[model samples]
Target: MDNQHVDAWKDMIYPALISKKEELEMLGYEQATPEDVWKCLSVKVWKGEPEKRLHEMVQDIFHLKSSVYLSYLTIQSYENDDLAASVEALLGNTENKES
Candidate 1:
């Protein structure tokens, strides 16, 4: 995956990203943002890309399905909850030791 390619295409793809974000929101993902949409595609849709071209990226964004994005959000939410629980458990252990 080439970060350079993604960076180079960022400006050109902004509108498409925004459109995807809006689509997600209309489907009830109000927290959706352009970054989230891009990340989901980069991870799920692109899936270890050699680096997609601008047009391909824009097309992917435009065609992204709500179900796929919803699944991504659900998994992400669970992962974030797990991380928070782990942190709380670690903090609880530290407090117990201090006491």
Candidate 2:
């Protein structure tokens, strides 16, 4: 994946991990280290394309309540930005065609 996609993935995962750390530990991951958790989650994200991974992350965050809605908001913001860019591109193409 590109750096931008990797960075966006990090932005989603890090906050969720930080907020869910205690819960994860309580759920039988107590012996696992931070890097271990990171590696596990990173692999899950890497298994899919960037957008699919992001959607899965957002759903996980919503269900996990990992960051108490923070992670969900972060992903939603990114989705909204993507939507806006798509809309702008479509509009620009239409204008160019008209011109």
Candidate 3:
């Protein structure tokens, strides 16, 4: 789906996202945000799916399991951490060679 279609649902689904985020917060994910909840859904639950119905999207948000969200976060952290590590290693090498 195009971004325009998704963007149209942002306002409509934001409350659901916030509610989901709050649920996450109560479960110890205190830093959770609507954006994070949305990302969790989009990347993990809706990955590679074509065209999501509004009810389907809402149900996915409401029914989202903590385990799934946590798994997504863990995977994302590892992927991101790997990139940061690689950049730091490269910069370290450059600085060492300069010295």
- Which structure among the candidates has the greatest lDDT? 3
lDDT value, residue 42 of candidate 2: 45
Ranking by lDDT: 3, 1, 2
Q: How well does candidate 2 score on lDDT at residue 97?
A: 100
**Clash statistics: count for each candidate:** 0, 0, 0
Count: clashes, candidate 2: 0
Best by TM-score: 1
Which residue pairs show collisions in model 2? Answer: none
Q: Provide the lDDT at 45 for model 1.
A: 86
After aligning candidate 1 to the native by TM-score, how far in Å is the CA of 65 from where it should be?
0.4
Model 1 misplaced regions, further than 4 Å: 1-4
lDDT tens digits, residue span 1-99, model 1: 334455567787999999888888888889999989888987778776546676777778888999889889899999999999999999999999999
Error of 1 at 96 (Å): 0.3
Clashing pairs in 1: none
Candidate 1 vs candidate 2, lDDT winner: 1
- The runs of at least 3 residues in candidate 3 whose Cα sits more than 4 Å from the true structure, single-residue gaps closed, are 1-7
lDDT of predicted model 1: 0.83
